[model samples]
Target: MSKRYGGKFSPEEGRPPQTPSERGSFRGARRTRAGGRVNLLFFAPLPLAARAFGSGPTELALNLTALGALLLAAWLTREGILAQEAYEARKIARRPAIPRKMFASLLTGLGLGVAGLATSGVSAAPLIYAVLGTALHGFAFGLDPLKDKGMEGVDSFQSDRVARVVDQAEGYLKAMTDAIKRAGDRQAEARLERLQSTVRDMLRTVEDDPRDLTAARKYLGVYLMGARDATIKFADLHARAPNPQARDKYLALLADLEQNFTAKTRALMADSTTDLDIEIEVLRDRLEREGVHLETRDLA
Candidate 1:
């Protein structure tokens, strides 16, 4: 997946510093700064006018126009920015940012502005535009707490947990698959390596936390199913070789390896370590169907 702030995905390599929660926090701060900027944009000309010209009717009118422009800009910017930032951040941080309701104020502000513009009479056009601008100002600023107040704590905890477990699983699988590639059958080996890395990522998502456990596990289960299918396909290809004797030997070796693979996976699944148990169960089931038993090992 293409990460916005981070580079390409590498299962074993350390991620580009910022975690999902960190990204969220950064986004929140950016929003706050943006709100401040919007406020400044609205009032910017007033200071220039005040410093350059003493209070006067012309200056007052110009300041009002500038203020209205700022409000309109702020309102329009919030929705687009929120949507864009959320989309980019999703690639790296998969969680659904619970308390998604916090953005309601922004929607409310944007709605009021649109409604005011739509219903205003010709004579009231300027008044309606000014009201819309105010609404935009409110929307841009009203969601500050949702972005800041205790949000980072909740998001950070889950982000770090997911990252740590994901890093470990990916590292382990990468090492194992890299070793297998040196034994010949590079194509099959490459497929296995890729499958394992994919599985590692899915597992990390499922293993992240219990909040969005249902969705995470569903996707993770699919990845495991794919992995199992890949292994089975490899076995099938080995069965149709030119030499019957060589094919039989290859088939026997694969069977032994698959059996061992099952046991090893079962061991990993059996561990009661992570907060997401439902995902662990789903992963175990998918592997078991393919005759690969996963054992969960407890660390503490």
Candidate 2:
């Protein structure tokens, strides 16, 4: 019998293990707010499926149409919640490209109205139900953020560049995430998520100061692409033959990449602080020249 290598590493060989607190810090830290009601929406329309199999063709048609519309509304609502969460997470973000939640509300009302019309036949109940359904859906999900945020005084051209680069980097991260899932190792998935978090820190830094995008371009583009490719290869190899050596190498690579990304983010922050200090000093000098004796007591 051949021995199959598992991806687990011995504590003596690998990097020092993370403390329980450190590991648990992120366990419940990140979750979307679109779960409970959104999931319920999926089941709520199941009864329509059975109704679609009615004896009358008109009844079947109406039920099938309502079912499709309701499912679409559920999908739109879930996507809108996710988009809103992403928007909120960023210090600077454009409004969502589509107002999915609002559209979902409209779709919900349309679905309900159609169902009511089919059952009640030209009654005021259908109109009342439509209005109530739209209102309730909107109330539950809320409206999409309608305006760009934290974009004042920032060059639109520079911001656009940063957005484009960040979007590309996100695609790379998504690929890595999808590929790693194929490996079926929970630890590896967790490790990849940690590395992704580090990368996102750098992304957020760049987004806050578009000027940093030029300096950090290589890290965001070339380095991240390489990491993504390596992840893809590792996932494939690990799935076929789970080699401990390969797993260790991959883990080490992730550690190095995380460290580099973290260091770069710190450097960018330091640069911003330096710029602020320079502006303050220039302002102080100008004030002194103008005979405005600003108190320096707080300089202690």
Candidate 3:
């Protein structure tokens, strides 16, 4: 066992060469707009809870109701911000149907109004609080996206298909990320994020051109599910007992998956370019046949 102390024991042996992507991409996750304000919203309703305990029965009921509404509003507001972030990130996405932020604003108003009602006792003050709170909430956080993004000139049905698959792929990635956290390894979490980013690129490619869905379906669906399951298993195993062998193997698996997904994404882009070329050629031929006489400059 004391023999060379090299090869597999050495850092350079099993480690792959630092790829440009790997070297450049081990950074942190993107910053989200859903952090500070949403977090504060969670704490903001605590005073209502405190007030609920010391008051009479009617006041206590009203305070409790207000607390529930305010907490729900906070939750909705956070979700809305995240949904908006996701919508903005993708090239093609349908509008969120529920408009969570707007609803959150209403709930904030209702909660404040109820809290005021408990103290103000049937006066104009409660209505004023409701209106002011609603306005402030709406002003602080804007409304949800009202229209479908990146849908112009694109076939509705095709875009829908792409959106559906991308959504499923995102769910799988989220699950993998959650499972990895149970292992409590920063390196593993970072590695998982890189893989998730790679998967998202392919997801974006499919979203950009729905035609690629046919080719990349299995990668996004079955392969993604398999990766998620593997991550879950590895995380569970690693959480039970720290194993260098298992960690290295899991990281290696991540590297392999990243490479394959990146290659597949590039291939999809290439196919899209070829399809564009074919379409251009067909158009040129049709124009020439119609005696349009597209010149060299026109072709360019």
Identify the candidate with maximal TM-score. 2
Q: How well is each residue in 1-300 modelled by candidate 3, as lDDT tens digits?
A: 577566777877788786545643344357899999789999988998888889899999999999999999999999999999998888888899899999999999999999999989899998999999899999999999998776566788888888888889989988998899999999988888888878887887887888899999999999999999999999999999989998999999998999999999999999999988888888899998998877766655
What is the Cα-based lDDT of residue 147 in candidate 2?
86
Q: What is the TM-score of each candidate against the true structure?
A: 0.23, 0.87, 0.86
Best by lDDT: 3
**Candidate 1 C-alpha error for residue 46, in Å:** 59
Across 8-58, the per-residue lDDT of candidate 2 in tens digits comes to 574455467764323522643577788987999999988988877864898
Which candidate, 1 or 3, has the higher TM-score? 3
What is the overall TM-score of model 2 with all chains considered together?
0.87
Q: How many backbone overlaps does candidate 3 show?
A: 0
Residue ranges of candidate 2 with Cα displaced over 4 Å = 1-30, 297-300
Candidate 2, residue 175: the lDDT equals: 99
lDDT per residue, candidate 1, 141-190, as tens digits? 44322332112335656655454444444445545454444445654454
**Model 3, runs deviating above 4 Å:** 1-20, 23-30, 295-297
